[model samples]
Target: MSGETIYKGNKKILGLTTLSFFLTFVVWFNMAPFTSTIKEALNLSKEEIGVLMSINIALTIPARIIIGMLVDRFGPRKVYSSLLIVMSIPCFIFAFGTSFMQLFIARAFLGIIGAGFVIGIRMVSEWFPAKQVGLAEGIYGGWGNFGSAAAAFTLPTIALFIGGENGWRYAIALSGLLCLIYGFVYYRSVQDTPSGKVYERPKRNGAMEVTSYKSMAGLIFMTLPLYGILGLLTWKLSNTSLINSSLANTIYVILAVIYLYNVYKIWNVNKEHLKEGVDKKEQYSFRQVAILDFAYLITFGSELAVVSMLPMFFEETFELNIAQAGMVAASFAFMNLVARPGGGWLSDKFGRKKTLMILLLCLSVAYMGMSQINSSWPLVLAIILTMTCSFFVQAGEGSVFAMVPLVKKRLTGQVAGMVGAYGNVGGVLFLTVLSFVNPSLFFMTIGVAALLCFIASLFLKEPDTAEHSSIVVQDKAGKEAAM
Candidate 1:
């Protein structure tokens, strides 16, 4: 039998994948550094500023589910390019916003771009086969995630260099231009799959599928956090009090109803198939994917939450200049270019479960070390402690995706979307935790979450080779060479 002509797994795919993220990420975090300028220009309060920032991520959870389905149907190239064009208008509105409401709507529209990350995972999976997915995903995620840091480093510098009250608007508008130009360029250069192969779509959509009624039931339960996190953000608004709680109550009711419907839809779609039993499902377990999804919820989630707060915590606690503090906080993200790829390569080589277990343990230590920080402690030590935490943080990111591409072959996009969304959910919950808690405790709480997930990992079985066999595919080029 001839091996299939799967993705070329070549440099061209890598270049396109990186470029896709670079464009998407700039637009995603374009609001961060410029928030002060936006607030001052519009005469907004800190509370309003906080809401503006939160709104940017608000739409992404649902957007991922929607875009994931779309990507599986239409393919990544169309979905990503189209997302960039539509999202540019929001970037322009955000750049030139005259009021908090304008900024709020722009930020909400910006959530559309966050779904850009999902498109790449499916695209990258198409290019790189199973053996290399870990490293490819690591490179993709580590580089892609660093876009936030890019906004931090470049936007402020651009704002400063432009040397005027309106410098931020220019900086923000620059992102729109990048998105506009790159959208066209990306379309011209990339294909859904290399040469002749057709990109496969999933058998179902709406909710991720599980083989058993129990796991299907669990999948329904898992979706609650996505909505709960949104409600948690709603409460964080200053006017959102418990007594006038009709909106929150209504949202909760809607979420619960949606979840029940989702469970029914998942079961209805898969019930006949499950009764027939998995044709190839004698092997594999959805339980493993569920655990990893939660594991990532804590690991990558903590990373997002920590990175979100670290700059502010460091600035106030250490009494450092804003410049110095931001620089220090940035070390956490900069670790990604190395730490994440290292995690993927390590998992690919050593063992997936062992690497993740070891990293989670180290992550627990890093968080523990961070919780010990005080004004009396040396700054170098504190910095080292944060970077130590970052290594495991990014490594956990690598480990998570390492398993993502290895899950049920056909459902890889759906699985990646759920796991990816959990990372965002982690950010929301951790930052919400930070609202009432102190910084050290904030870091420690994440540690506690990681430890719980780590304990859960103790039950996770390393993915077996046969797991990929259900959707059988082979590399045609390899087969041709062999013949």
Candidate 2:
């Protein structure tokens, strides 16, 4: 019940949940390093490869929203476990994928697994008290996010050891094995919260409930990016530089209809709740969620996009070997363990708004350093820029989640899902931008986005009280609660 004891409980469960959540991400992006072999095996065109990469993230647009609801309804245990075991099937299928469509389908299914991060957001909230939740959530995010880097390090080596033209298959299969094992271990070892921690379930099922018409409009406005990012995916498919025009057109139509239908569905589901008379229930201010979403879109989103491309930038510019490039690029993620937790701790000791602004300013300077890179520059200087960029990149990540749990209690998972998805949305958006621009522009674009986030943070209202009293549905969880 005490803050320190609650954090101890949170730390224990977050550590375990982070393991499960991370495996899905590891296997999700495993294709990055192995794409060359896959393209050769399938005799695929460059356009097909682009489409293949795009498909891997295609389904996650809807999956995050749905998984958030499910975690809120059923708790993260069943959802997280089932996600792992189920994702492994695709990992294996992808390993042996003989045709382009086969790999595409498998990768698309894998996208849903990214939503695994959201479920743990709520789980972490239940275990930690308000004051410490930011640092707790940062650990969940920073550690779990490293799974991608793990895939970068170990997966290719596993493929090489298998020793064949089809070595990539062995690598992917090894990832599948990890998924299968972690699934059971997570299910068996972890509880949604400590035995003494309370689990809060949200009041409604379909969409986020808003307290007033003005906020409802704001909610609608916020969802526009979720759909717009999906539209970007469709546009990539249709682009002649990427995929076949005919198929892209079909996919575009499908995506457009899906977005429209999602808006309609969420509007209908929450229509009654949106009415002022239905409930005077207040959620986190629309402004807060919006600010956080933009912050994450810049911070986490930049990390995702930059990481995806860093290896290539190094290899081409400095003429480093692929392995060397990957190692250097991956040093950015190394900051995750310390920087993310440091961000949260700083926000707790200082103030959330001040901490976020400082990090955002640091990020702007970091981008300036990154933009200066050229073939003539010393490699050490480049590494310093990367490490410097990484500190702000990860510290900003820490600050965002530090604010997440304090919003509304029960909806932490959904809130986290939207924010997390925006990170992916940022990935898709920034990557798409890369398709049009140069690498320097890439760094500059992120710098501009971070500046926007800095301005947005000024609009955020800090939580003045320890708890925001919203109705938490008392089920079996209430009995176990230390609170």
Candidate 3:
């Protein structure tokens, strides 16, 4: 579709999908804004509160991977709508829970909704061509991501408006209700692709299809780190006495088994291709996907970690009140509204590889500057530095996905899924680093990681946009046709 046609013809789809993503995020992060209130009401310890927060993200690591496959198999429209509808159950459970276990189980279940972001990656890609996809995906992502800030800004006021100790409960439940209703609206409003276009399904659904044996090895090597991050999370919980040594060991064993099973799936899917070799035109490098994975790990990972801690960092460093600190910290997230789309626009105008490398370099430098902030620095200067850093960080995220759809059309959902999962892996890894070091050191760690990703991004191969192909077609007699 032409750019103007997209605005006129596909605008409704874009609007509805973006709103669906926004509502899912609101439900996914509903608890974060009211953590203190919940902690007070339950008489929970700091360790218990930490577990509750950790539980919010734990399942998302795997959920993104699973949802990616589902999107590819069932199509984004159905998968996304089903996710929102089903996840609302946990949201309601968490809203009413009076005990720690109830709250913990419900919060963990809510993590499944976090996978909603990957679904729209495929949906927006289906609607927009390679030339326009970066900007389209950026708008979907940048606007949808604002849901977290929306919850933070409005949910507390909503609770106050309800006026009672159970006010937080009602406010949380309201998000669930909105999510439940929007699920139906989204199902009715959107289709998997534009008119007369066939949705491409991956030949093998369980694991990504790699082009070569070397790439297969790289994919396996990369998969290990995801499991390692889970292991680290388990260790962290064990260290905090959240679980016993025996349970941690059992979880470790489970992860190892899952990893082995994934390897089998990868082999099962790609073994035939390894023997016969894929068509040169059909093959793309897994190295490109790996580099993007690392880039997102640093960009989105730091964003999640910084957003979680920046308010406290401001409060501690500037001796500002909690309210002032929170408002200042919020500027980081607020940058997503424009900066992400700007990054995507730059990627489309310039070359994708060049745009990504520049953003990563700027991100590394911005974080380095942030590492030097202290009590003596002006508060205005601190906020400026934070927002400046945020722009590059979020824009880097936009650039990463700008190329995602271009990688392999059929595997776009799975590719987006694995890359998106790495983002959560980065969050868990960076936040764990924060637990060991002070704020300044934590900032330095992120800066160092970004610098490394910049070097890795130098190896990325730009997606070929010389000719855009339509999806495979089927004839009336069940014969396959190429576009």
Candidate 4:
């Protein structure tokens, strides 16, 4: 195919996949905007409401890991479309749910929809050449991520226009309906890759293949935080009295056993390969993935944490009305549409490592500025700083993913999965910190973490090839050989 034809075809696939991602996000976070409405309708206690919020993210961490594996083994077309169609059931369930138990179950299941983000990383990487992959991934991510904001802004009005006690229910269900319709539309409209390009699956599927025992050990070390964050979530629920002490302890034990089993799976998958030794061409550093994990832990992780609280911060610090504060807070997320893509473009035009380092360093400084915001400071100035801080935070996220696909072609889904899971881990950890400290201290904590990530970024290696268009073909015996 000519370059021009490939470019034109890519635009269509990118748009379709990004739209799938956007609609999933819309359904994933649909409950958030209706928090108060649901509470009032259900006559729920504050603690129950808190539990609802907590469980909504509980499944997402593991879902991303599982979805990543599935995307690699099957293909994004099947996995993503199935994800959208299946998740819509939970969305509909939550929409009509009247009791805390019902809503809680629905929302918890809906968390799996968040895994849709990882599928797109693989899909976009497959379609766009390396030179343009960063910007393309950014557009997919940055635009799709806007769905949450879109839900927040549009859903309430949708409810009001429908105008009834069940208006919120109808509004939320509409998001579910979008998912249902789009699931079929997306499956029909897109392919796993362009017409001539073969979709590659990982050689092994249970766990990521590690080139060295050291890398295996590193994988085990990193897996700890994922389960540890789940433990933290359990602890939080225990404190809220959502789960009793005995139940929480039981959950803790179960989590530990599961973690150990996961470690065994990782070892089991990689042991043979490590014993024989991988060919030099196939060997890539686990350290690279580890670095990206922490980098995301700082960038997207902080964005999740700050977005949750910035409205309350503005409302209290400036004494603005709720509506006024929300509009101001929206500015932070508003940067995603531009800054994330700009970050990727920079990574493409400049260097990935250099762009990420600059963004993280500036992110640290921006948070330091945020940490100092007070009632004495003018609100306009504070909002300006907030937007600036958001630009770096989001752009850094774009930069991180821009390099994700380049790490290894076959492992893109699994790699994106682990890194994306860390972002949530960061969110949970940072929010836990917020629960213990003042807002200023929370900002300072993230600022300090960003500084550490900046130091880590210094070690990121650049991808050798600027474009990954080399073809991989399979012979009759079913072995892949790159051409």
Top-scoring candidate (TM-score): 4
* lDDT tens readout by residue for model 4, 222-306: 9999999999999999987679999999999999999999999999999888899899989999999999999999999899989
Query: lDDT per residue, candidate 2, 1-483, as tens digits?
Result: 444553455556877888886787798889988888888889999888888888888778678888988888888988898889988998899889999888888888988888888888888777766667678778888888888878877888988888888888888888888889888888887777654445677777778766666766777788888877777777766665655678777776877787677677667867776653553345457677778888988888898899889999999999999889988877888889888988887877787778988998789778866877899999888988899899998999999888877777777778888888888899999998998898998898888778777877888888642554221333464443323
For each candidate, what is the lDDT? 0.79, 0.80, 0.90, 0.91
Writing each residue's lDDT as its tens digit, candidate 1 over 249-270 gives 7776787787677667777777
Q: Which 10 successive residues of model 4 have the least lDDT summed? A: 465-474
Assess candidate 2 and give its TM-score to the true structure. 0.91
Q: Which candidate is the best by lDDT?
A: 4
Q: Which is better, 1 or 4, measured by lDDT? A: 4
- Taking the tens digit of each residue's C-alpha lDDT, what string does model 3 give over 230-256? 899899999876799999999999999
Alpha carbon deviation, residue 370, candidate 1 (Å): 1.3
Assess the local accuracy of residue 278 in candidate 3 as a C-alpha lDDT between 0 and 100.
89
**lDDT, ranked from best to worst:** 4, 3, 2, 1
